[model samples]
Target: MMKLDGVVAFSMTVEAGSISQAAQRLGLAKSVVSERLAELERTLGTTLIQRTTRKLSLTASGETFLPRARRILREAQEATAELAARSGKLSGPLRISAPVGFGVLHLGPALGRFLRDYPEIDLSLELDDSFVDAASGGFDAVLRHGAVGDGRLIARRLAHSRRLLVASPAYLERHGHPGTPGALEQHRALLYSNRTSDWRFTAPGQGWSVIRPRAALRVNNGLIMRDAAIEGLGIALLPSFFIHQALAAGTLVAIDLGVQAEGAELFLTYPKDHGAAAKIRAFGDSLRRSFGSPPYWERVEPAPRAAPI
Candidate 1:
């Protein structure tokens, strides 16, 4: 095969007017550049450069070979750029699975931007509450909360889900706010079916404790939990992403129970064995950037505190 490394060295050395300048341009040592010129001349069976103390001059043979070497360098660069552009242009079937509530509520804008940037990406997004197996379900990536289980998969965390204990002004006014976790037993609890009656909480000084609130309503979806809380049905524990808006608008007040539950994290998981596909990486990066460090949803302004009934 015709080697292009020496060809590049020779072309740059000529164009740069000196070996040192050529090395600077090529990001290689001057000695390495000289060696390349020597090796290239050896391969061509001719002295391509007349090296001296003052400057470098091309031999008649070097002059004739110089044009061909420069042409070779251009071709090599064009070839590299073509392959790079092809790789940069990510396009393929990108199958993904996510929880229905999140996908519908928050993922719309992110998905829109991704589609605009990569129109060639044939996107297949399945919004379901259940955990979907990326390998068996033929999904390229899966958006999941909590823990990512499956040795076959590699996970990238998107954000930490901040759970909030919330109740509407009406509900608090009617039932009175519970000041302590233990006092929550007297209040109505709207539990998520995915969650248990045993809710865990902790504080910087208070340590960890489990609060088994009585469940008045249990549903499989977060929206139902949120809406029930909004409608003054009961106090609901929900993700900050789902209720930050209501909290900011004063439709719901964040109940500080003197402790906080550790939030489950959101993850973008892909098959570890399938190799990192361009489309999957692109989508994952987009989501991460959208979420940012603290996540855009968590940026809500602090809501007004509800007073005693």
Candidate 2:
């Protein structure tokens, strides 16, 4: 009989485009993964992959066998999911990836509740701002904000947010608030390094406007940017979810440019096949419930403004 481990190892290596990456995803040693692939080739009496110093390519036989191998893996996963569903018990490892700020601010509580509800499910959560390929990363799901561009993954909308321009009252009092997007070019901007410094806005009469602000400080983390903005460093265009607390507390004030900023759609993304996994489904549902329509973080009322003299 063909060894299932060997078949899986071969398939994962092909998908990952490198043996090291495959080994990382499989939680196995690189040598073990290579051995499994070699064992599978010997059992089949055929060389499936061509290995070279630069890259690995599939042999003609491998090209033909790749789809079959994937199908086998899919069917095996579905079989396990079916059994788990029938038994009505979610027991397995569920790996997830999320943005660092969101994971810290919101996912922690949601996960606490999820863990209590499903004690048998094992959870692994990775937080980072870098883009993660769900398949290669071996993540069961990824919580993402903004557009879901990958056609290979299925996305479920969790909540909505907006990116707005904000500055501390002290900063605005010192530097003066810009009445239009064009004026932002003169001000120091605290920017998220991963994103463009150019900010965009739209309004009923204003149509659309974009401005490239001078970056006084650029960092990968949103929390750092938020802190800088609070310290009166400069203006920042940040996700509403990230600054909601500060905004509500009157530490940060929203600048109305007579136009609305872009809306951010939050999503929980996963492979289509993973939709059948009980753990994935349960977790997804819990997130939907926790975030609700407006999301819990957004539930606070706007801070009361001082009366005009």
Worst 10 residues of 1 by lDDT: 77-86
Which number leads on lDDT?
A: 2
Candidate 2, 126: how far from true, in Å?
Answer: 1.2
In model 2, state the lDDT of residue 81: 76
User: Residue 11, candidate 1: how far off, in angstroms?
Assistant: 42
The sequence of per-residue lDDT tens digits that candidate 1 reaches over residues 43-139 is 8888888989999999999889887876666566545544543566656577889998889888989998888877877898999887688767778
**Which residue pairs collide, candidate 2?**
none
Cα lDDT tens digits, model 2, 1-309, are: 688899899999998999999999999999999999999999988999999988999999999989888888888878877677556567778899999988888888789888877788889999989988865577888888878888888888888888889888888888887877788899999998887767888878656777889999999888999999999999999888899999899888888777787787888888876644567777887887877778866676557654211
lDDT of 1 at 208: 83
RMSD (CA, Å), candidate 2 to true, equals 7.2
lDDT per prediction? 0.82, 0.85
**In the order shown, what is each candidate's alpha-carbon RMSD?**
14.4, 7.2
